[model samples]
Target: MQQGSLARYKLYPSSLLWLDSLSQAGKDLRARCCQIQACDTDMVKGLAADAHRLLARGDASGGAIVLICLADRCRDAGELVLAREYCEEAVSHFSCYDDCRHAHNLAVTYYALGLVYQSLGLETDAIGSYDRALEAFDEARSQWMWAHECAKRMMNECDEVVRWIRELRQGLALGQPAPPLLTGTLVKIPMWSTSAGSLLRVREEPVDWVDVEVSALGLANFALLINGNSMVGLGVQNGDVVLVQETADWPADGQIVVVRMDRMESESVLKRFYRRQDHICLEPANERYPFLIVLPNWRLKEEVSRRYAQSHPERGLEFFLESSVHCVGWYCGKVG
Candidate 1:
């Protein structure tokens, strides 16, 4: 947490440890946590007792800090389940306190939870937690950065990257790009297709089709205005239109594809597809966004949903969540 240029000084001024740095404060807590780490079942009971005592004392802020530390201690000690429970409770307790007072600590608390989730193999949840931590840290930095800028009369952003972001990316494989694969085909001839066939399935379908050229693709291709910055790492900026070729085929490793996850009504996500041994991995180019792991059945989803909706006219529009990843097409290239 202390790796950043600004974080070294602004971590805990007067709130948790007064003038003491995190390392200085951890000495006593670490000693006791080391003792708690030895016992198997008793560790859980001991920490629970410690948390209860801390909370019951009416110092909610202090209790939250202690809980966060205890949660980290549990994480380091290989007690994954206990780490998750305690860190979550710490977040719950700390949430009542004003954001101005404990934003940085709350960010750390969320990071600790992300670590626990990563340990348990919940990759998506881990990334989601990290995203939350980043948001909290951003909030925490505003006041400190503002005060420092005011003192110096400088109008500039702090250039240092936060420690948690770097640490999580390295740990979660978010920083590493997948290895390249050889493909014989430089370009495949796409079958002549049009937008007329695909538009029938969507409820709020687009009426006017733009003639954004996708090299040679026609009837089988579609366009989407990129909505989020999740793919900024790929030079895909927000509001830029992307051309996609219509296909339901599973993409080769590291191939970018447009797929709708969770529901048919949901907006499609542009991601790098990697098929793992167990689950499918759909990763975004940006670290700020969380990647997905799913086993979707898009065809089954369409069948069941359309049947249910058509069978019951009085129900208006109600569909089951039968899929998690519905492949819209493979990404052709960015148009705008």
Candidate 2:
């Protein structure tokens, strides 16, 4: 099989040889054309000729298959205009039939058309073609399991693009000034234990939406409700909601940050960050809780001496592997 023919077969397995009228010679010609490494202008023209002959013989399915194969090849070769034309032709031929087999063919053909339109920067046209493909796939689903599965996957892929395009269009239509405030969710912090400075486990539950100043907090921000008074010396108190700016960059020394300790079950905590020569240190604002040290190799080691540990029952800290520690974001300020 030629590369183009193989690609078409992989994309539309159910419709590759659905036409009963396709001669062995015609199929052989398609395979031969597709196998050639370099498909020059003459070779492409020859494939087009074969497709035209199939259509002339009233073999719409066969012709559409050939056209779809050509479209795939042209698109791969960066011939968008030719690819679009071939896809449109294939769709037209597939539309002439009404059976389940032809419905599957139409589904694949419309999907190919969508790809062409998407590559050409015609997002609206691409979305329409994807919708048509989805509809055709729905019509064929009872009799064609492959079409149904393909349609489901294709719909998943197109959904995000369609949403982004619609949002862009809406923004352009509105032509309004950017909003002054951004909405951020305030999330509850789960406690690790009854210890005052213990690690806080962060969950995905949003407690409520808080309007934050766009100039101050930016768009990517969230609020965490303070659970303990470990950082009271830094002006943070229990019941205070700390605003945080989401970032992937390393936090500066002495900056407060939300740190996640990666374990089989990950846990998070807020602390002041410090980078030493050989390890990183997470220090609490109050002196009661010992500072947690993350070694150069990503292991968490505590600085508490045995004598101090014996005196302060709640002062002991566990060793966390360095790979398990990540800085989620820097603390902005207390949320009003």
| Strongest candidate by TM-score | 2
Q: Write model 1 residue lDDT over 54-145, tens digit each, in one string.
A: 57866556555656655544554566788788788878876675543366666667766776787677877878887887777677667556
Candidate 2 segments whose C-alpha is farther than 4 A from its true place: 1-196, 297-318
The digit string of per-residue lDDT tens for model 2 on 1-336 reads 222221212232122324444555445444433333333557777888877887898767767787776666566556779879988988888898786667767777887777677667776787688777767766765445445645554444334333433443344346532111111222222212211267766665655555433222321246677778789898887778766645444455666777887772555777888776666768788877667767645322344334336765676444555667887766766655
With candidate 2 superimposed using the best TM-score fit, by how many Å does residue 28's alpha carbon deviate from the native?
64
lDDT of model 1, residue 157: 18
Q: Using lDDT, give the best candidate's number.
A: 2
| Model 1: how far residue 99 lies from native, Å | 4.0
True-vs-predicted CA distance for residue 74, candidate 2, Å: 50
